[model samples]
Target chain A: MTGQVRTVDGRVAGRRGQATRQKLLECLSEMLSSSPYRDVKVIDVARMAGTSPATFYQYFPDVEGAVLELAEEMAKEGATLTDLVAGRTWTGKPAWAAAEDLVDGFLSFWRKNDAILRVVDLGAAEGDKRFYKIRMKILNAVTNSLTDSIKELQSKGRVDKTVSPAAIAGSLVAMLAAVAAHQKGFQSWGVKQAELKPNLALLVHLGVTGKKPTK
Target chain B: MTGQVRTVDGRVAGRRGQATRQKLLECLSEMLSSSPYRDVKVIDVARMAGTSPATFYQYFPDVEGAVLELAEEMAKEGATLTDLVAGRTWTGKPAWAAAEDLVDGFLSFWRKNDAILRVVDLGAAEGDKRFYKIRMKILNAVTNSLTDSIKELQSKGRVDKTVSPAAIAGSLVAMLAAVAAHQKGFQSWGVKQAELKPNLALLVHLGVTGKKPTK
Candidate 1:
């Protein structure tokens, strides 16, 4: 009830209004690259968007609210693990193979959108309460998919009977988070996508198989 | 040259003056529990500390600088992964044991000073350049130790050989992060320590050993 809603009269606003809003958010995200969330002002944001200060308030309760909105938007997407490994017949594939595909999918998302991904990292860094749920929800989805695949593999008795798929599922996500964290930190350091692929394949294989990769 | 450090003395002038400065920074971290970072102000900080706004500027240039100073102070100690897992030798302690100890250390720091941790998260959440580097440095230390252990195990053939230790290492930190994120998000939701431990342990064993518990 307290947050701002972009919709009006039960209809999503038009491009002109949306364009103003979009430009404002974009500038805000860029500003955030160097500035902290607490220090930004509505006038500063409006000026950055080249719009009237009143326009800034029209779309957002305030600049912080606008940034929160952008962060939420960023949270809504990324490459899912299942999308990496299987299409229609996931159960048919080896768990390690499926995991590799998932890692690649995740890395690809990081490669393309390091800035937005950094937002998730920062939100969860230590005691950041703001974006914790949104970030966790994303993690849960990844782990849940891994669980499904592992359960399928366990049913086939293809996986190590001593291991639980759910554990592997959660672990796999944690490992990927490290990779994403590394990518965000080193993006300005000229990280080549090729360099990270081997690491991803290696980790994914190890994560699912409970053994180090021979390849 | 452009920052608050004027290059003259680069220090507080007197003892009472220094105490006031420390109190202001310290209070912000705790006060942030009910207040969002953006909602806090110099007046609130000064009032809470029983000081004047004029006196606050004598130390910090502004509120953001004050928070950053605290984050820098915490990170100045600079812990490594080896420091965490060392001095307690085990051939291979179950994932839960190591995880519990590690989480205990992290949460101990967090619970004692939620404000600074909260600020660190906010700074990082905003993904400002400085915040990401600070986060990566701390996590990298944690991951490096786990990675080294995994590699040692690989050489001894005690663990899987095909998997990259780096992957396992990455997963370890990421999962811990997830639990920490959980703890942080539910601070007001009344989530307790008991609910968090199993999750942290589950992540460690699953991610590292890739095995379900024998216990």
Candidate 2:
């Protein structure tokens, strides 16, 4: 578990400091949604939080540092994604259900934190290791679980041995993440949201089972 | 075909003016790769182009305007992606080859223009219609062709009738784009670039033909 929240000066944040820090994060989060990451400034976040810029600096070195702090918080919540795949059977009706649940769960999570995830994705794509590590922290929770499910099937000869579980799982997760990020793109492409989800579930089922789903 | 290039003021750019304009775009494109999109400025691009900011203004309204011009050029190149699927037969070995070639072609194109494409992606994801349209112009060139191929297979009963060709094709193209955008992420996950391509081809072949490739 994460230790107590601390200020930039290394002092553990007291209740008042923690409250101010949380307010600043909330304001920063809003700025990320409304404006591009590069345009988000500490002064703006501080003004929105009704605090001084010096106080903002006391909690975070810079905007990127605060964004990383926000991302770490989200990564902790991402741990819940394990339930979407762990212990889920990939056979018959249950397999169909599993795919649907996974797609639904994954999409909802991405939608909820899309603003931060976008910055994380951009930073990671730009080769920033800090952002990349945070992205992996969030995605690996679900990806590792799916990889295990695929490997379990491979062991029983239910899936092909030539198929790399890690690759397939990673690809499928990438597909899900991409689709979730561009849900509006799909809608504009003439595929409705309802129609889009089922097809995504179909692809997930196909990727995991290597066969058309029974449903 | 596009008519003669024009400045933001609606004047047709002559040879000398066009050269300055193109230089500004080239400089802006380089800036996009080297710096974050939000931080890219018209003044810097103009300075790098060895011209005044007024010259940059004559050619483009803002950084985003110049970026849209660049994206337009890339979308024209993306039209070539249609050849990866348009006339290719998708039965048996030919299907596998088609999938491999599509993956190869798409990944190379993405890698070549990733920096601009990243901004375009961010713009589109932020609901900017101009950027979204350009993105569609690029991806639709492939997605529409893949959709037709799926529909063709469905007509012959090679693909299931219940499947939505648009959805399946969109998902596959999204997968390719996502994978291309994050090739390094795969490498870091122990799935090398070499390993990643074949698995992507397999999924593409499976999604299109609904069966394992002959290879």
Candidate 3:
């Protein structure tokens, strides 16, 4: 559906086209942050953006299309961080330290996009066909990042050989969704990482390095 | 929206109908097990037990009401198992051994009602308000069950103290959702729980007992 949206004004083509779409995307994202996906409509998004419904249709076939596009963009942005974690020179960092940094980078991204991420997290399990596709894309991006890292560690004999990297990767991926559900738990309780992050790091570290967590 | 479903007796009610409505609830439960909640419309449900839409309205206001009624029933049935877990007798079984029996009993129920569970999971998340209420009920049921077991272990000094029992309960609840998501992933791979449940149980054991599973 997003594919059908042609940026209006062929000259709304390059930088201008991108800027216009970005503005529209930005508006829809802002609205989603405060509301559930089903509650918000394309017309509502357009009105919130101070644009015409027709203008919204110019860049998005519907609300889900716009949301999926934004999700894909965020997923890509998330990918760059994964790349950073993967590409980092691991020479000075201990294996555990590297894993900690990767998760921290991931958490910070979630923090920055709290609203959009909240909506996506809430909507991902829904039966919506398009929403599921965008979600799986993001999940793959995260898993692929971890899979490559684990495979590298395995090749170097730095991690366990018995567990499949994909299984470990799946666990690492599952842990994020697990923790993210409680992101709101953070705001409500004001708990610090000294208590939470370390325990979580232990779980992921065990999954990755295949060592028993430090007691 | 569920507060208005007319029953199959073709009688909309106000006809000394309380007993007749009770019969309809029993019929609705039987029908839902064999059909998806989303697919079970008022008319078909009414026809199934020799009733009419008018009589259906006497009990449930609508479809959500029928689903809500059934979900509530399932949770209550599940609580019967919870009562055993919370008992002092322990059935003289090892903890995981007892847990396995409990899990098998619960899962057997799920296996037969896969269609309804799938519908409820999807409908509750998809934008159906009643569905969300049902989902919340299920979460509460799991939390209560775990709370009883955790408190029992804590009193015996079998559970970790550093982690809040609340976190322990929540962590377990979430791993189940992750289990469901993993099962969903398998569907794409042309697989099912036959290939996933044992691994899922291993992960659950890891999460709940804070013991790294050797399996």
How does each model score on TM-score? 0.74, 0.95, 0.66
> Candidate 3 chain B: minimum summed lDDT over ten consecutive residues — where?
B84-93
lDDT of 1 by residue, A102-124 (tens): 77777676555555555555555
Q: Each model's C-alpha lDDT?
A: 0.61, 0.90, 0.58
lDDT of 2 at A34: 92
Top-scoring candidate (DockQ): 2
- For the second chain, the TM-scores of the candidates in order are 0.77, 0.96, 0.62
lDDT of 3 by residue, B44-87 (tens): 87887688987677667887666666676665565554543454
Expressed as tens digits, the lDDT of each residue in B98-212 for candidate 2 is 9999999999999999999988888887778998999899999889989999999999998889889999999999899888988888898999888888889989988998998
What TM-score does chain A reach in every model?
Answer: 0.72, 0.97, 0.76
What's the candidate order when arranged by decreasing lDDT? 2, 1, 3
RMSD of 1: 5.4
**Residue A6 accuracy (lDDT) in model 2:** 90
State the lDDT of candidate 3 residue by residue for A96-146, as single tens digits.
566566667666676677656544653444345555665566666766666
Q: List the residue pairs that clash in candidate 2.
A: none
The sequence of per-residue lDDT tens digits that candidate 2 reaches over residues A10-67 is: 9999999999999999999999999867678999999999989999999999998999
Clashes of each: 11, 0, 24
lDDT of 1 by residue, B1-215 (tens): 32433312376356676677779877776666557666778889898999888877777777777777777766655464346665433244554577667767755655654556556655654556576666666667776777666677678776666556665566456556544544544433343466555545544554555554344
Each prediction's interface RMSD? 5.1, 1.3, 5.1
